[model samples]
Target: MRATSRFLLIGLASLALAAPVSGQRSDDQILPKSAELQKQGRALYSAGKLTEAEDLFETALAVDPRNRGAFVDLARVAEKQHLFGKAIRMTNKALQLEPNDADAIAIQGEAMVELGAVARAQQNLQKLQTICRQGCPQVAQLSAAITRGPTVASAKTPETPKTN
Candidate 1:
C-alpha cells in the first residue's frame, strides 16, 4: 500500500508539471499587464491626449518593467510631442526587447525623419522592405515622409520672383 501511494504521488507531480499556467506569459513573450492600463493608454494616445497617455503608459511600465507594448506606446507619445530624441531612446529599448517589432521600427524611422536624419531613416525603410516584402503601411508611410520632406523644406524657403 505504501508503494502504491508513492507511485500516485509521483504521477500527480508529473501531471502538475505538465499543466500550463493560464494567466502568465512565457519568458519570450511580451509581459501583459494585470489591468487594462496599456489598452486605455492606447485609446488616449489615439485621441491625441499625449500627456494622459504618457502617464498611463508610464504607470503600466512601473508595474511591468519589461512591457514591450508600453515602451512602444511611450515612444509614440514622445514622437507626437516632437520629442524626437526621447522617441528614439524609447523605441530602442523596445527593439532590444523585440528585435523584429514592426511598430517600434516604424516609430524609430519616424523619429529619425523629424530629427532630419534622412539617411538613417532610409535604413529603417530598407529594413521594413525586407521584413514585409509584399509591402506594408509602414514602408509606404516612411516613403511618403521622405518624398514630401524636401517639398516641405522647399516651401519654407521664400522663392524670389523672376522678372517678366
Candidate 2:
C-alpha cells in the first residue's frame, strides 16, 4: 500500500479511537468573551497591528486559559516579531491543548526553520504529512518553508575612519 494511503487509514483509526464519549464536552464550546477577543486579535493581526493583536490574544487567554486559539494567535504575533523561540513555545502550548491543530503544527514548523532546527522542523513536517492529506495547504506551506530556508538579516558595514 502507498505510504500516504496507510497514513490516511491510521489517521482515521486514531480519530475513531479518540472520539469523545457521549458524556464528554464537545469541541464547539467556547467562552463568548474569549471568542470575541480572539476575533479582535485576528483582525488586528491582519491589519499589521501585531502589538495590538498580541495584547488582545493575551486578554483572551486571561479570560479562558484553555483557549488554544489565543495561544495560536500569540504564536503568530511572536513570529511577526522575529521571536522564533517564543513562537515555538506558544505553538507547543496550543498543540498540548489540541494535538491535531493544523495551524499550530504549521506555525511551529515555520518557527523551527527560523531557529535553524532542521531536524525538528522535519519532524513537524512529518506530523503534518500524517495529519494532512496530499494537496493539503498546511503541508504545502510547511514544505515551501523548508525549501525556502531561513531568512537572514543583512549585516550593516561599519564606517571607515576618515584620513587626515
Clashes of 2: 0
On lDDT, the leading prediction is: 2
lDDT of 1 by residue, 25-122 (tens): 66455455623788999999989899999999999889877788888899989977778899999999999988878888888988887778889989
- C-alpha lDDT of candidate 1 relative to the true structure: 0.83
Error of 2 at 76 (Å): 0.7
Query: Which runs of model 2 end up more than 4 angstroms from their true locations?
Result: 1-28, 153-164
- Runs of candidate 1 exceeding 4 Å displacement: 1-35, 150-164
State which candidate has the highest TM-score.
Answer: 2
lDDT of each prediction vs. the true structure? 0.83, 0.88
What digit string (tens of lDDT, one per residue) describes model 2 on residues 1-164?
A: 69999999999988888776655654557689999999999999999999999999999999888889899999989998999999999999998889989899999999889888878989988999998876478888888888888864323366899999
Pairs of colliding residues, candidate 2: none
Q: Which consecutive 10 residues in model 1 have the weakest lDDT in total?
A: 146-155
The TM-scores, one per candidate, come to 0.72, 0.77
